[model samples]
Target chain A: MDGMVLVITSGKGGVGKTTTVANIGAALAALGRRVVLVDADIGLRNLDVVMGLENRIVYDIVNVMENKDLPVRKALIKDKRVESLFLLPAAQTRDKDAIKPEQMKELCEELRQEFDYVLIDCPAGIEQGFRNAVAGADLALIVTTPEVSAVRDADRIIGLVEAEGLRGPRLILNRLRPDMVKRREMMDIEDVLDILHIDLLGVVPDDEAIIISTNKGEPIAFDNNSKAGQAYRNIARRLEGEEVPFQSFDNPSFFQRLRQLVGMDK
Target chain B: MALLDFLSRVLNRDEGSKETAKQRLQLVLVQDRASVNPHLLEELKEDLIGVISRYLEIDLSAMEINLESGGGDTVALVANIPVRQVRRSQQK
Candidate 1:
C-alpha cells in the first residue's frame, strides 16, 4: 500500500512532538488505517512509554537497521488499545549517530509499502537526529507553542527543513491556553500564524486531560469528552483530506457575540 | 467601584502580555531568520563602494548595512552610506 511518511518535529524541546505522533497515529488507526509510529529520538526515546508499549519492545528500529536480514515487521510492536496501530521503538542504548539518513530513507521506503501512514517522532534540536527524522519523510508537521523561544526555533527549523527539500511544512500550535488568549495574556492563533507564516494544521488547547492521559499511558484522542481529544480527532480527519472547521477556544461574551454578529469585531 | 474596575481592565487589555510576547518574538525572529552571511554582506559593501566611488565619494567608516524584517515573509536590506562629496567629472 502506498503510504505517507510524515515527520512530526519541533526545533525546541517540550513542544509535544511525540504526543502529537502518538495521538495522530492512534487517531488514524481508529479510522481503520494501518499506522506505525517511529520514535527517532534514539537514546532519549520516550514514545514507547507515552504509547504504553514500553514493555513490548523486544527489537527496535536500530535492530532492523543493523541486521539487514531482520524484517521490519519483527521490530514493530502492535498497540494494545488501537487496532492497526504499531510502534517502532527507538534504541535507548544507542545514540543519534547510530543511524544514517540513508538507512532511514530505506526503512521508510520499506515501511510505506505496508502501512498507510508512517508517523516519525523527530527529536528536538537541529542535530543529526533531526536530519535523520526528516530524511525519509514526504511531509513535515512542525509542533510549537505560543511562546517566543519556541516560535524563533520553529522559524529556524522551517528554513532548515526547506533547505533539505521538504517544502510547505504545516504547523501544529500546541498547549495553547484559550483563557489567556481571551484575556490578551497569551498570543492568539492569528499572532502566531503571522510570525510563522505556515499553514496551521490544528490548534490544541491547553487541557489538563492531556497530563492525566500521559500518566495513564493513554492518548487523549481516545476520550470523546476531552476538547484536546476532539482537536486531535479533527486533525486526523484533516490529514485524511477532510475539510473540518477549527474549534473556537474563546467563550465570547454576549456583547462580543453581538459585535461579531454585527461584523464590528476584528 | 466594581463597574469602574471592570472598565479599567477592559481598557488596559491592549497592554497585555500577548502583545509583548508577539512583538518580542517578531523582533528576535527577524534576527534569527536573517541568516544572510556577514561575509556576503562585506563583499557586497566593497563592490558597492567601488562602483559608487566613481560618481560620488562616500565615507567607508560610517557605512551601516543590515537585513531588517519587513514583517511577515519579506526582508529589507537597509544600507546607510554617508556621501562625502560628488565628483565633478562624469566617469565613462
Candidate 2:
C-alpha cells in the first residue's frame, strides 16, 4: 500500500506542534492504520516523552543514521497503548545538524514502504531542523495558535513550505479558547484563516484535559470526554478521506437550544 | 466610573482586542510576506526622490515610503511625499 509521510510543523515553538503530532499519530493508529511518529527535533526531542515511550527508546534516529550496522526497525519503539503505532525518537545529545536532509528523505522513503502513515514531529523555527523534518514529507500540516506571533510565523513557514515544493499544506488551529472568542477577546478561526489563507484541517479548542493528558504521558485523542480529543479524531478521519463536519465551538449552547426546539435532543 | 467604562466597552464591541489583533496581524503579515529587503527599499526611495524631484519640489526629510496591505494578497507601495512646490518648467 502506498503510504503518506506528513510533517507536523509550526514556525513558532509552543504552538502545539508536538502535541498535535502525538495526538494525531495516536488517533490514526487507533484507526488501525500503521503509523510511525518520527521526532526530528534532535537535541530538543520531546515526541518520545509526549508519546510516553521515552524509556523504550534504546536507539534513536541518530543511531540509525550514524551507525551503518543499525537497522531502522530496531530503532523504532512500538507504542504500548496502540498496536499499530510506532515512534523513532530523536537523539537528545545530538544537534539538528547531526542528520542531513538527504538522510531524512531516505529514511522517510524506507518508512513509507512499511507504515501506512509516517508523521514527523518537526522542530520550531525555519532552521536546519525544520528543513530536515520537511525534506522527505509528501504533505505538511501547519499548526498555529490564534496569537499574532504564532500566526505571523506560520505565514512565513507556509511560504517556505510551498517553496520546498510541498504545495497546499493544510492547517490545524490549536489552543483556541471559544469563550474568549465569544467575548470578542480572542482571534476566531475565521480571522486566522483570513491571514493564513489555507485549507483548515481542524480546530482544537483549549481544553484543560490536554494538559493533564500530556503530563500523564497520554494523548488526549483517547479521552472521549475531551472536546480536543474529538477534534483530533475528526482530523484523523479527515486524513483517512472521510468527511467530518467541524464542531461549532463558538456557541454550542445555541446549537443545543436549536436541537431542543427541533426535538432532536432526546 | 467602572460601570460607564464597561458600558462604553460593551457599546464599542468593534474595538475589542480581537479586532486589534487581527488588524495588527494583517498589517504585519503583509510586510513579512513582501520580504522586501531594506537595501532595495532604500535604493527605490533614492530613485523615487530623483525622478519625482524633477516634477515637483518635495521635502525629502518628511517623505515616507512603505509597503501596506491592500487587503487579501495585494500590497500597495504607499509614498507620502510632501510637496513644497510644483515645478512648471517647459524644458525637458
Give the top-scoring candidate (lDDT).
2
Spell out the clash pairs found in candidate 2: none
Please report, as a residue range, the 10-residue window in candidate 1 chain A with the lowest summed lDDT: A179-188
Angstrom error of the Cα, residue A117, model 1: value is 0.8
lDDT of 1 by residue, A159-181 (tens): 88888898689999999998788
Q: Per model, how many backbone clashes are there?
A: 0, 0
lDDT of 1 at A122: 96
* Cα lDDT, model 1, residue B17: 79
DockQ of each: 0.75, 0.69
TM-score of 1: 0.85
Per-residue lDDT tens digits for candidate 2, residues A1-266, read 86999999999999999999999999999999999999999999899888788888799899999999999999999999999999999999989999999999999999999999999999999999999999999999999999999999999899889989986899999999987887678999999998889999999999999989999999999999889999999999999999999998755578888998999995
Worst 10 residues of 2 chain A by lDDT: A248-257
